[model samples]
Target chain A: MGPITENHLPRGLKLLLILAACRGPEPQIPIDPTRSLTLQTDWKFTSPFSGLFYDYYRNENLIFSGDLRTNLILRVFNHAGDSQYDIPLKAVLDTLEDINSCALFAPDSLFVMEVHSPRYAIVDKQGRVCRVSSLAHALCPEPGNRYEVSGYSNGIASNGRSLFMSAAWWGDCDNTGWDPSISRFQYIQRYHLEGARKCRIAKIKLDPDGSKVHFGGCNILPHLTDVPRFSYSGMERVLLNGKLFLFSPVAPYILQLDTGTLNVVHRIPIDFLNGPAAFFPPPITEENLQNGGDLVSKPSIAGLAYDTSSGYYVVAVLHEVPIDTPEGENHLDRPWSLIVLDQTFTKVAEHIIPGKLYRPNHLLSTTAGVYVHRNIPGRAGVVGPKTFHRIILP
Target chain B: MMRKVIIWSVFAVSCVPGSQDARLSRYLQEQIGLTERQFPKAIVVVSEDGCPHCDRAFADLVRPRTSLRDCLFLIRIDGTTVDLHGFMVETQNVRFDDDRSFKKLAS
Candidate 1:
């Protein structure tokens, strides 16, 4: 047979090649939210991080749930979704007042931070309080920074000697009223385990000057008042490979910082298909406040998790849906996209998840798969035995 | 006798809407500084426990209509003590149910 050159190829084959060359990159596979591996637990699953969105740590095959005050049962599950152990945390629950953030500082101990005060405790796996201390006197005041340790602790993690937490900061830190003129900022501060402020690592401005419309309080303001979904301002923290990485839903980059130097070493850019969505909520005017309606909702990066086994990163992109669609009205019911990136941060696969079946928030990634909250159609936050659906990535 | 009393109490609470509504109205009026003349035709209850987006949408829907402003009383159930100073400045009849009396009535 003669060499099959371009001219020698059939007409139909030539046309097919031309069409294939003109076509864009391959489309993402549409993932059916219902078609997933389910994790049935004996106890009802309540989010451990009270009001804040959180991700739990996965050590080897075991996944440890957060130890915040809102946790009903401190659960430890294997990669196979079977419960290894569950602690009620009754012994230490009473002692830790309004626990907001929890981190495993030691192999068998949990470092917990409070919501109402600058107090923290070290509790063991057996729910026994090892030590308690308050940070009110320890934190040295910054000249311009009105650092409020209580309530503003967004992302908290411990590296044995120090604890790091992000604070959603605005004017005065009281969060009494909304001022559009002043720019909002997110301050990540490092502190000694004993509650003393070590250094301010990073301070990134949250919103463009006067961009947001309303500020109800510190809690409501960070998440945006009247906009019910998770805010782009909320920072997600991960302690990987002896380095701390901070990622905000809104920011396009994951900040890798060295705890010892307190310097942001690397700014790893998240290469999404078409960058992160541009979020702009409708201006909450005085007239709207007085009289009542113009609010615009936007899509956001719901959650981010790193897989220990595969050295891959899985991010949940909460895509915006039409307001008229009944199922898409709530933030939890919105359509989602699962983006899988390799160790080099290259996009490996993308899955388009339809709304109303699953919530991509509070993602727990492991060797087996990424675990997401399986929601019943119509009803929101219904308690049941089976907690999450495991989505095994490609 | 105790069981009978419990059943009767449950019946009184569940079945008696006329007295309960009136008491609730009076209680709400007093709590929110509502006048007898300014009776609300619609009452929008926004709870922190409910979907935040839906609550915000409801607030947005009712805000633009001047007719709804006079007839509607927007009651918000906050998790913590809400500073009503900002709420009072608005022309809309917005009230924070701090005492959780509304939650009690619903329960």
Candidate 2:
């Protein structure tokens, strides 16, 4: 072949270059570091959990909590504090065998929860199961007898018209071993507010033969060039100018897709507010180890919430540090941090949550108060109930 | 003769597998007890849905590869499954209680 001309370049490569060049530098926005409030509850729960907080009537009077374990959403409150209601999700959970993940589709007045039995159910304000859809049934007919509906929906968002959610296909990941080369087939999907299947969406599959692909285990590098292979995780959707902005926590990247054309128009890099590996504790030196310190780090983004008030997305990251002890076990404490990014998906602000906070799975903004559910370890037991903080966002 | 030699060289290069991918596969098998032969038939079973660790596990299993063809029959499984025979091959090291059972037979 003679010298390749511009025509030789693939359409994707050309478009990528054009978008990269045309897109102006991301605008910087200031973040109010003190713009946060926390409401602690006397309750606590065991690990391996999911939760949601919502208000039914938009009365801004009653707030509710749904715990995955009790399989019941109950009305809860403190006599001295503001009035809060816990609406039992049993009506919805009863329709499904088990719940995997849940979200409050605020715009639609519906609570969408995913079941490991391979179904999504939409519950109404009265806690009645309004609609139900099987994820496996919609995705594949012969989805195969070997296929197990992996319970790992990382992110859930809505466009007022429909609910968009993403899940990492884990069945293939677990049995196939932990090779980075073979990872990437994890699937993501979108659903209607009524729990109807919309689309399975696309997945980036890594080469199994492992020629061009290289796996880095669990950690993700900010630079794409650093790894030959990686996958998307924890996706969040925001409607910007009639288009959909998709954000993934794993890659810390955002994609602007035109709804009309269904084409990706732009890819933006998101900068976490905390420094690289900021979630993890420092390595144990001889001095530190002697003093009862060990190497500990929790450097993953567990939650993503779009804050419409500030025109930015707030990310909940779990930061952990190992306690200095003889066993050198990791004392993973959740220091909730918010990384704010503007419409362009640029990092604007970063704030670390103070006090003893556990992993936060959901962040909700309501007229009543900002509700957040903390992911507590299962050992905490079913009694005492898990903590759900209703903070009045500043 | 030169033309023939050049053609043969090109064919040989095409047949040779990339070392990088092989190294990666080896690394994965060693670290996670996952291997190429097993990946094609293996199914991933996650502890919880929407859990980040499960996400990481899936991401690592499906990352892109250069030398390997997509021959693996990968599947996603939930942790609640009482029986995993269809997806997981019974291994000697894996043990289950009366609540579950796994018999290791020659694959």
Report the lDDT of model 1 for residue A338.
Answer: 82
**What clash count does candidate 1 reach?**
5
Model 2: how far residue B72 lies from native, Å: 47
Residues B1-107 of candidate 1 have per-residue lDDT tens digits of 43443344345444648867777677657766677777665554444454434443444444344345544444452221111222322344665553456556644
**TM-score of each candidate structure, all chains considered together:** 0.54, 0.43
lDDT of 1 at A385: 42
Instruction: Looking at model 1 chain A, report the run of 10 residues with the lowest lDDT sum.
Output: A186-195
Q: Quote the positional error of residue A348 for candidate 2 in Å.
A: 3.9
**Docking class for candidate 1:** incorrect
Give one digit per residue, the lDDT tens place, for model 2 in A1-394: 6998769999999999899999987533222223432333322321122223223344332223335432355333331124344456767656776665454545234434455454566666567776665544333322321222232443333333344444333433224354454422221111111111112222211122321111111122234222222233334444433455554434345566655443567765544544442222223233443332222343455555554345555556555544432121233344556666667666766766642443444555443233455444332322334344543222
> Model 1: residues >4 Å from true position, as ranges?
A1-61, A66-72, A149-155, A158-163, A170-233, A240-243, A268-275, A278-296, A322-328, A377-382, A387-394, B1-107
